[model samples]
Target chain A: MPEPEPIADFYAVVPAGGSGTRLWPVSRAASPKFLHDLTGSGRSLLQATVDRLVPLAGEDGVVLVTGAAHVDAAREQLGLADEALVAEPSPRDSMAAIGLAAAILQERHGDVVIGSFAADQVISGRDGFEQAVREAVVAARAGYVVTVGIAASRPSTAFGYVRSGAGLGVDGAPSALHAVGFTEKPDAATASAYLATGEYRWNAGMFVVRTSVLLDHLARLRPALHDGLRRIAASWDTGADARARVLADTWPGLEKIAIDHAIAEPVAAEGGVAVVPGVFGWDDVGDFNSLAALLPSVDGSGTKILGDTSAVIRVESAGSVLVPASGRTVAVLGLDDVVVVDTPDALLVTTRARAQQVKDIVAALRERGEDDLL
Target chain B: MPEPEPIADFYAVVPAGGSGTRLWPVSRAASPKFLHDLTGSGRSLLQATVDRLVPLAGEDGVVLVTGAAHVDAAREQLGLADEALVAEPSPRDSMAAIGLAAAILQERHGDVVIGSFAADQVISGRDGFEQAVREAVVAARAGYVVTVGIAASRPSTAFGYVRSGAGLGVDGAPSALHAVGFTEKPDAATASAYLATGEYRWNAGMFVVRTSVLLDHLARLRPALHDGLRRIAASWDTGADARARVLADTWPGLEKIAIDHAIAEPVAAEGGVAVVPGVFGWDDVGDFNSLAALLPSVDGSGTKILGDTSAVIRVESAGSVLVPASGRTVAVLGLDDVVVVDTPDALLVTTRARAQQVKDIVAALRERGEDDLL
Candidate 1:
């Protein structure tokens, strides 16, 4: 089927950040998870995210917001025009990132609807993703903060959940529902119970909102942060010097808050948030174990290789995740559910069950002042 | 304690062979285990073996017999004189390696008692080892093939077992006993049963016997191999060209038999074999798990590092063996009893329980034409 026509009056804003400490050695401070091709898809996660959004938002309507240090890399990978990229002078959390994008897009083209998708996430079922975004755009145009709630595939405690109340009864967004509440990562039992209730969906941190609506919500909920982002966005397109001046002046002072707490939670409570069912498969690709789930098994033993298969030699080893990124041969013997991530400067060996604890290793390295490895 | 005087007419024949496939990536065919410091003792196993014997055999009495390709490396590490090193034209197993050394020593010194020790075994308790060798030398002078049998520390199935029988009653060799028989690596149940019997000891492949007695046994049991070694030994001292000519002509055709099958087992049946109890701590360092036992715990968690400890970072990982020989930082998280052998060109990740299966990985790599990794 041909690609769906670009959504009218809609812009896609991709906020690429997070050090992804748990995926260390592969995901590091300088290059993080979004810059690597975690899925062996040839395209980096940031590039894949832009690729997914460009057709929906139109080539010119897609905007990228990333840390200043990563601007060159993200631009080189995505090949986005300079004006379409927004580089934050410093990390001020998701609020400043997405808000700055929404404000800048409003400054460039009137108050258009902007969808905020994290560049580090993985999503499949492109048609389903497009349909959800289309419906989310309609809900956003109807003056409600819209979040695409992923169909909870598992009772995972890795992500927060969004609770749908009643159908929004919007003309174009048939699956849109009134978002009643948002909850942080819940306990295992609570997540299972939420799954049983059929109303909870994984909050993928994806928000589609009209520029005016998000700015109004942010102004009411976090005035200082809203003012700082607006000031930065106002000069973003004026000139490189002016943009740099405003960013350096305002970005550092912006409140460090995730978008969830800044707007989604309060707005949902005030009956101004809508949840569109995202039937597409989605994952944050949090750790090696989660990465194993995203990768296809390379052999009958369920071994997954993210790099050169020829570089890995497994004997009686099953359910292993091997990342032979160092251009060296890796030999695994009689181990099951093992994670071996080999890089040129560092190597990580752990088990699938212990993948999340990789962050502890990174923390210990930091504590020991091995920042070069981190 | 003062060092004991050199034994009278005793020569040390160190057969430095075996690719140590079970310890691959570190123990390659080119370098092998004997050339590696698996115990982190700052000396290669071959060097330590020679160090242990230099005092007992006198500097000129110690001879190193290894493959032609490894001669230079062994000589570089050992600094042995050209006359003290025997380089085989090709691998012909233990019989050729040890017999060649015995014949050469006898041809030079006239029927001297020669002690054959593997270059790859690790031994502690220097005094006990010295005592055992001294007693074995006496037993060897009394016309019996003497083997040092290590006291069974555990019911390990990795090595063969030597069953001790009646005492030899040789003066000055009180610990020497008539060897009843030898058993290859047994099943767990048989190994446990062998350990229960007070008579069984781990066979460490150490043989002490008069060169005349060993050559005579070879003549009686396998005259062709004996004649071939005698011819090689005859020309070995004539000149470098003659020695190379004889070795190239005779060495390749020699029988490829381990000493146990060629002499030890059959000689025991004829009541000519004796075993001197070795009270020293010993291990072949068969695999990473066995290597772990040789290394002192680097942390309270019982983690063992065989190379630069600073290159390894462990978190919640207990009882793991790490060989960070690549000069790369190896981070291990939440894995117990895991073996991570990191090298510049190859890596091995396995568990202590499956350490023996590492050879299987090497075999698989070889099967896949990845001989460079092997």
Candidate 2:
């Protein structure tokens, strides 16, 4: 396909440190989000994210940013080349996780372009995604931070959006656009209106920018973060300082904010950001409910499960989800649109209408210290 | 109490030759109602019935009557003395089952009184039940078929009733009443009206009668049954009439009919039956639904289940009879008056409104040849 244009300059950096409570029970404290092979793709979302990035960044250039607590699982599962992972001393939110990666890359590769990616996501049409990221890189190298935008389908109030502007050139060079604006997750009416505009894209929390560009932008937009990151990088050579001193001091001190709010939007509002439409399908597997939706349909009618459920049921009971085996002869008589998740210590039954609340149920369970179920 | 009344005349003849599809999973093709130790009471209902008789029949007279397939379980669980046990050729219904027992007793014991009882019934207050049966016998010895009437507390539409007439005779015989009339299970309004009158007593399907009295009544009333019974009994000892075997040739040919319709009610309607009210709690453990009502409060205020219930749940889900421990763990949540029955191969989650139809469900399952569930 056009000799498959080489993906260079841009390195993909995944922030793999989220303790996603939204997928508790299934995704637990011991082995958190990035390690869950939730989509049954035979690879954790983190591994898949890395694989997806390899096409866009060339294998040797990809790096992962995760917490000290999770570094072991990350290394054991992702199997990357040497010096490819950065473990934070403690976990901070997106801003710090991203800032650490950018600062680390800026010192190592100078002004090389990097794409910030979240680990919990699914993407299809890699060829198209690579093309989109390469296009985004052009904008990033031309002195603008470009956040990949997933074209909006429905009025999902759960995600932030980028409002598109005019195209820049034929080669899409410097792929410039006077970005209209950025909106954090909106209310229903605002999202509905945004959806109608056709140019709004769900902010995938993914952004493309040269290492120097992100750090330089952070210096201007959040000076404290820029300073802290520089200090953290200087001590990396000692390696010992990386975990105990540098990260402990840096992660907790970095802005408790999203990258959009702390850097890109602030930079964009000042007329220095670009938006590139993501041409491939991408999903942030934010929770089990969403994760179930993305996995290969277990029933051929959309059922996904894991484990031995023979002890659970022996009949489908007319289309119920029995975890372990989606079609374990379980009888769900008089029940509809329900999920029967049978685990060793606990079982859960809730309709799809309330599936999102399972995490809340698990939260209450955790609060009671009934970790047996967890 | 009154020297514990000697626990004598305690012979129990459980007529279990009737196939009751009303109880399926437990009462199956090879094993029927009387064979089931449903309550884990250390004694099955039939076993309990025998124990009830033991106090009076003095152990040796505790007789068990079951169909051909169930003869082994009945005898094994009841531990009846040889010749005290009776096996039918097939399910000939209670009328013929009771007839075969009566005729066999007629030639062998001469003028002995007999207590004919259903095997699938739960009776508490054993001392009180023994007294009630003894009282019924006293009345029966004086030329009457004493049908024990359970003291009716609720206007339940699931049972037939006996109209208790004014008291007569002495011991005060206060318990004995002339059975003015018999009524089959009535509609709600009629049962409510019957309850208001206070003259109705639930038909317990238990009878105490002098062998002579029963024989005379059967000969006068259901001639066909009496003749069939005679032929069956004649076959019991004499292998002479090859085609007249009690457990072989006759049982399957005997008309399928309830003892109530075939004899008791017919005699009561003809003014030849008497009623004796029983204070002891007696329950026909007819179905899992009935088990809920009869078993000691399954819970202080929620659902109760027996057997393997991993398959059954009664959420809020209260008042359900889940049988998961019959093999599985049955958990009920957020439901009220639900019946979750978990079996090895079958599970039933039904609402209280449809509790009566559980038999229908079992029937449909049988018709579908879902034998595993059955």
- Candidate 1, CAPRI quality class derived from DockQ: high
- Models 1 onward score TM values of 0.98, 0.72
Tens-digit lDDT track of model 1 for A52-130: 9988999998888888899999988988998888887778899889998989888888899999999999999998999
lDDT of 2 by residue, A1-374 (tens): 55554466667889886666666545666678778777666888888888878766776878888877788888888788647878776666777778777877777777788888888888888877877787888888777888888877679876888987887452555444556679888999999999887878888888888888788778887899789878887776566745467666666767677787888777877877788887778777665556665755445444455454332322223344445422222334444445555433344455555555656665656666756545
Tens digits of per-residue lDDT for model 2, B32-87? 66666677565667777767666676656756677667777776776666678776
Tens-digit per-residue lDDT, B21-82, candidate 1: 98988999998999999998999999999999988999998999888899999988989999
Report DockQ per prediction, comma-separated. 0.89, 0.16
lDDT of each: 0.92, 0.69
Residue B300, model 1, lDDT = 92
Which candidate leads the pack in lDDT? 1
- Extract clashing residue pairs from model 1: none
How does model 1 score by TM-score?
A: 0.98
